[model samples]
Target: MSAPVCTIDATGIHVPSYDDVLAYFQTEFRGIYGSDVYLGNDSQDGQWVAILALAHYDSCTMAAAVYNSYSPTTGQGAGLSSNVKINGIARAIPTHSTVDLTIIGQAGTVISTGIATDGTHRWFLPSTVTIPPGGEIIVTASAEDAGAVEADPGTITTIGTPTRGWQTVTNVLAATAGAPVESDADLRRRQKVSTALPSLTVLEGIAGAVATIEGVTRYAPYENDTNVTDGDGVPPHSIAMVVEGGDAQAIAVAIASKKTPGAYTYGTTAEVVTDRYGLDHTIRFFRPTAKRVKVEISLTALTGYTSGIGTEIQTAVAQWLSELAIGEDVRYFRIAVPANLDNGADSKTYTLTDMQIAFNGDPLGYVDLTIAFNEAAFADPADITLVVT
Candidate 1:
């Protein structure tokens, strides 16, 4: 037996009906404002009005719109009837950052609808709306409010209903952010913020590289300059990953202090740089191409010891170094016996924030460093905490 005509199409498949198309569109815009509405104006004052603000109306259900009028004679005559009709009532969205809505077709047919806000933004429109049946209006499109801090801008959600005679105006307010839009104003704002050298995308790269100090640098615009540039030092430019126990200010300060000390340069190609996160670094090379290069990092002088540069800070630098050693076979910074300092006198507890490490050839340079004692180091230390790797 053959399938029914309504259920069969080209190769014998169920063909959807026009109602199905309407249903699909409706589902797409469900819950969104202006998702349901008709086209046209049912106004009195012979003027076109916006119908973008309506309740219980979806964009898929709108059709044509019209307006009606009533006239009476001076003394003895009855009344006369007439009406106006408008064809298309569609909105035009801007290309890049702006958006706009207009009333074409029957002039004076559309009325200004009231305005509303979605907590975060505001929206505007004609007095009321008159969406016709079998037509589709726009729901919400991107608008051009530009960096609203709290509010980005708004997009048109729904047009209101327009009825015959004088229709009550309602729901018309400005939007904070709009959709399906392009506004020169918005573009200009973005361009201004994006003018910095590293630009916007660099912020992301910096964030990914510096896991410990992202919030302090990325969340605040004040330090944007710090993250994008390579500070003057041995390692040239490197993203800092400064971390604090929790506070952002202390982290920022520590970063500045570390940079001030500057790095010791062994040679032009190899130099040292401490990360803003207080990770004292001996960055000898970068984007390495050599298959293997003999490298050694030392931290004997770091643990709890004061130098011509820094103060005694570490309670146990060895513990910190062991955790960072990825390979385990060949790992991090530790407290090494000094070349001259003897065990009794040298046994003095000092922070070995960095120790010596060795590796060769691979682009993935190995970092074997000692425990870093920063900020609260002086106040947070304990006496006999030994560092053993």
Candidate 2:
């Protein structure tokens, strides 16, 4: 009597079905116990055969999982993390949001434990900040709570821990949004991009090198190879790199290492890199301007509907917007996909009647929104409005 076996070949791993395994077991039992032996549903032997079949099916599934673990594309969790190591990258951990805060006070004043708030979340200053002769100091503040905590300009007006000479605190610009734990989909995408580090084209190599930098969450590189500057404002024979997160010096070094010798680097942030030859070179890159997106979703509630489900839909839409790549346009229908995903059965509780999107301060419409090459679309869950009837 032969047992059911999973096959692995050039095509892929082929698993045996439970029914196939059961039939094989039944045939073998008949071959041993005699041709006329009864193996009905009520018989003890029948029950034993069903259990054995299920066990064999589980074994086959485990084998398939093992095979998939060897490849980054099919692996998950720890297996995926291990495979990405070959590309010199790792899973990105959660990061805290940062903002540049203006602290005004008398000259020579020193603050040891400074904290600011935007009414909801707390942002912490460095261990100490001394007001320069200018009577005010601009310092970067990290959000006390990690992950996408946003504060608009001038919103952080409250000084949580007031010092004797510290008069007021406020943020000059919007907070640079933080990110949650990197998802498997994002990791795989980065892994693929990293493989271009040694590609034939210089542009691909530059993009690949920048993508692997530590703390760098998302990046896009554009090249203007022609004689004149491109429409995106990249100089001729130069590259413009738009990166969301990373150390300035590390980004400059990565760009300098992979960029063409005479080609220009363009953007707002500039870091000076000294070559081994003792020559100083300036590398420039852009920090993307986050354009907050507004989402309006109208749906009809069905059975099992709840306000919690509506919140889930809003989160799903916001997350989808956040994941769009630099310069990627926001499509009108794309917003519907995430909202209707099977998020713990919440998606089934409502039927979408209409969906619309717009940039901050713009009227919401059912039209695709264009994103500039140097800008990225950001959506806060609070900005996602759901109308459920």
Best-matching candidate per TM-score? 2
Task: Using lDDT, give the best candidate's number.
Answer: 2
Query: Candidate 2 — what's its lDDT?
Result: 0.86
Residue 43 lDDT (model 2): 87
TM-score: model 1 vs. ground truth: 0.14
lDDT of 1 by residue, 161-205 (tens): 333332232212222121234233322322233233242555333
Misplaced by over 4 Å in model 1 are 1-114, 126-130, 139-389
Candidate 2 weakest lDDT stretch, 10 residues? 341-350
Clash count, candidate 2:
0
User: How many clashing residue pairs appear in each of the predictions shown?
Assistant: 106, 0
Q: How does residue 69 of candidate 2 score in lDDT? A: 89
Residue range 1-389, candidate 2, lDDT tens digits? 56778898998899988889989988988888887877778989898888888888999999999999889899999999999999899998898887767889999999996899999999888888888787876666788987877888789999999898899998756777787788898899999999999999998898999888756777898988899978888888888999877656678899999987788999976667899999989898887778889998889999999898888888888888988999999998878788896545777788999888899899989899999998889887898998878
Evaluated at residue 356, the lDDT of candidate 2 is 82
